[model samples]
Target chain A: MIVAKRKPFDEIMEMLEEYKKVLVVGCGTCVAVCLVGGEKEANILATELEMARKLADNPIEVDSVTLERQCDREYLAELDDKQTDYDALISMACGVGIQFLAERFPDKPVFPAVDTAGLAVNQAVGWYEERCRSCQQCVLAWTGGICPVTMCAKGLYNGPCGGTNLGNCEIDPDQPCAWYLIHERLAKQGRLHHIKQIYEAVGWRDTMPRTLIQPGYKKPEKEEAK
Target chain B: MSTDNGLKSGSNLEKILKAGHFAFTGELGPPRGTGAKEVIEKAQHLKGNVDSVNITDNQTAVVRMASWAASLLLVQEGLEPNFQMVCRDRNRLAMQADILGVYTHGVKNMLCLSGDHAKFGDHPDAKGVFDIDSMQLIAMVKQMRDEGKFLGGAEIEHPPKIFIGAASNPFAVPHEWRVHRLAKKIEAGVDFIQTQCIYNMERFRQFIKEANDMGLTEKCFILAGVTPMKSVGMAKYMKNKVPGMDVPDEIIERLQGAGKGKVAEEGIKIACEQIEEFKEMKGVAGVHLMAIEWEHKVPEIAERAGVLPRPTVE
Candidate 1:
């Protein structure tokens, strides 16, 4: 799932600079699962903002709302006319959702409260690790399920650099070398020869930012009179 | 020396290799700060003694003076510099731009390495941009030079003219596959191969033998890397700590036998012995002395190895 971290408190306050009435928006999807921008966290942020404003003697009023999934326009209709009560809105979702809110409320100032890290998996209750860079091209089949593009320090599709010591990466002793794992997995399968398979220089053209269209979906502009 | 004779001159390092000279190249770790004083001074000790000095790009992922700039600085001192480029930092566009930039500055030799990760360095939070790995990097640079076009097929006037190099670590995992990997790098247009630091003499000898059997030596100049252990602690650290580096126990034993204060001298003696072995090792073209943070000792090491009186291309 997409993982995001809260923007530093100072930065969040800075984003609401000069705003008395603010809306703290949250997402019920990925950001919520990561515990950064869910409804509970949104209330905590709103309370904190209220306390900070009261302490500053500015006494700003705040409203909190969490959408089912902020990326889709339909879920956002839950706000209806109530969103205009605030001078600005701070999105607690990922970058995609922030852009969605901005586009939906073109006139309202929308600030991003979270920085979208990468696609990550939950490692522990409070810990998450990024696993995919979404490079669009996957080579896991050749690498024994290891993602060299995301794991290797140099993202070397070939193998570990001369720097790998033991099983850990030369860069970080705590991190296991991605190539080492690939070698181990391939060796266990008696497919050591697979490790020798050299991948040519990756043609990056296919991995460039691209859009996927749903099949058989006829756009209104392309649809005939029917 | 029948092995030595007049040969074609390309880059200074290439000229030395072509002359059948036992070439020695030193590593110049760029300084973290802007002042080039320390780097230039360190390089001064290497000027007359080594064939070509290598300037590292942010070795260990620590920010340092740009390797290209350092290489240019060494050029000003009448010394040849092998500018090293790492893949962990830039994309193809920046890489191609820097290639042209380095060539314009008269830096000739290039060492293409997949740089260490940023997580190891001071800035663990910095984003890594490994747009291309070392092999692809080698092919791309070759593309620029031979085809006069970018990796993306865009034509550029006046391609970078320089010798290309890549690294090999026989001690890396799947150690048996290292030599075959060298073959792949050669196929990618590498002109020279600098293997990881040598300590496991037996393994390196085997690696060289296999490389020879594969006829890799004829395809590219292979320089075996040797780092002089500064102390018993260093020997132990590299042997046990550094990844892919195997400092045999016997060498550490020799260092320990050096008693207390003489370990440094013993390390140099060991390095000299390695150079002597490299001179006779089949398929080994030269010795790349990696006196990391110990550039001052390069001259003495080269002199002790009897590779002094560096061949003059002119």
Candidate 2:
């Protein structure tokens, strides 16, 4: 899931200070599962903003709403009527959701309330760890299901560098060395031959603002003229 | 075995090792600034005492003068530099360009390494660019040197003729796999391997034996790495803080038992003993003396280790 964390309270306050009235928006999907930008968080933020503004002798009115998923246009249609009276919109969703909100309400200023971390799995109620970089190429089958691209600090393609000590990374003792884990897993499965093969340099497709057209979504070819 | 007549790169280090002489190499870290004074001064200490000097590439990830440029400085001083390149700061294009650039400047030997992570460096926020690991870098250089072609399969007008070297760590975890890793590096076309510092002789002996059993010793030159412990504190720091460093407690206790002012002498004595052992150990071709920041002590250590009067090979 896409994990995100709320931006610092001071930065969010500064962004909304110029507007007298604002609407706080939240998403109900990934951010909600991560416990950052759900309906409950939006309500808490709205109440805090009102109290903080009142104490500063700049009383302002704030309203908040939680949509099913801000990335989909159908769910975003719910904000058409409620967004007209606000001076600006504050999005507590991930970066993608915030951008979608801005694109829909082009006239109103949209400010992000949370910083999108990365693609991760929820470890516990409040903890999460990154699992994949979505580098557009996956090599899990050869590496015993361990993603070296995300797990290794250096993202090494071959075996471990010279810094693996006692199965831990040189950067941090608590972080287990990814190659060490891969080696043990492969050795246990009797697939040690997989790591022995030399892997070529990774062909990174990290061009910014990448767009992926799923197989069925790609445009159909033009019909041949008879 | 390769001989001087069939030298691959004609580097002084390669020639010495090829001539069946016990090779001696030292390491020199470039200064943090752009000045050449430190490089030149350090080069003077290793001039005739060692076969070749390794110019480190931002050792420990700290920013410094570029390794290739520092190596050129050594070349200008009539010294051969085993220029070190790391995959931490540049992509493949930059790496290949630097290899070609350094070769034109008279640098002959090259060492490929996956550098220390930038998080441990002076600029912790710097982005690390590990476009290729050390293994692939070795194969790429070999292809460029032996086949006269670039990694993209484009023919080069004049490809770099480099005697490639790579680092090995026998003390890293999954201990039994270390020898197999050496075999993979050998298969990748590395001509020589310099291991991590050795304080645990028993473990190192086992590693060398395994390498020999697997015929890795006959394929490539294995140089044992040794660093003199300056004091008891340094030993403790290496054992506790440094990764892939296996400093046995006995060595630390030995340094402490040296009494107040004799610890430095004791450290050098211990290094000399290890070098002496490496001289007799089978499959060991040389000793890479890394007196970090203590380059002046290299000549003295080399002298006592009986690797001097350095060999002169054609």
TM-score of 1: 0.86
Q: For model 2 chain B, give the 10-residue run with minimal summed lDDT.
A: B1-10
List, residue by residue over B50-131, the lDDT tens digit for candidate 2.
9989999998899999999999999999999999999999999999999999999999899999999998999889989998
Clashing pairs in 1: A164-B243, A164-B244, A165-B243, A165-B244
lDDT of 1 by residue, B192-267 (tens): 9888999999988888888889898999999999999999989888877777888888999999999888999999
Shift of residue B157 alpha carbon in model 1, Å: 3.9
For each candidate, give the interface RMSD after superposing the true interface residues on Cα: 1.9, 0.8
TM-score of chain B of each: 0.96, 0.98
Error of 1 at A27 (Å): 2.2
lDDT of 1 at B269: 93
Residue B146, candidate 2: C-alpha displacement in angstroms? 1.9
Q: How close is candidate 2 to the true structure, as a TM-score?
A: 0.96
The stretch of ten residues in a row with the least summed lDDT in candidate 1 chain A is A217-226
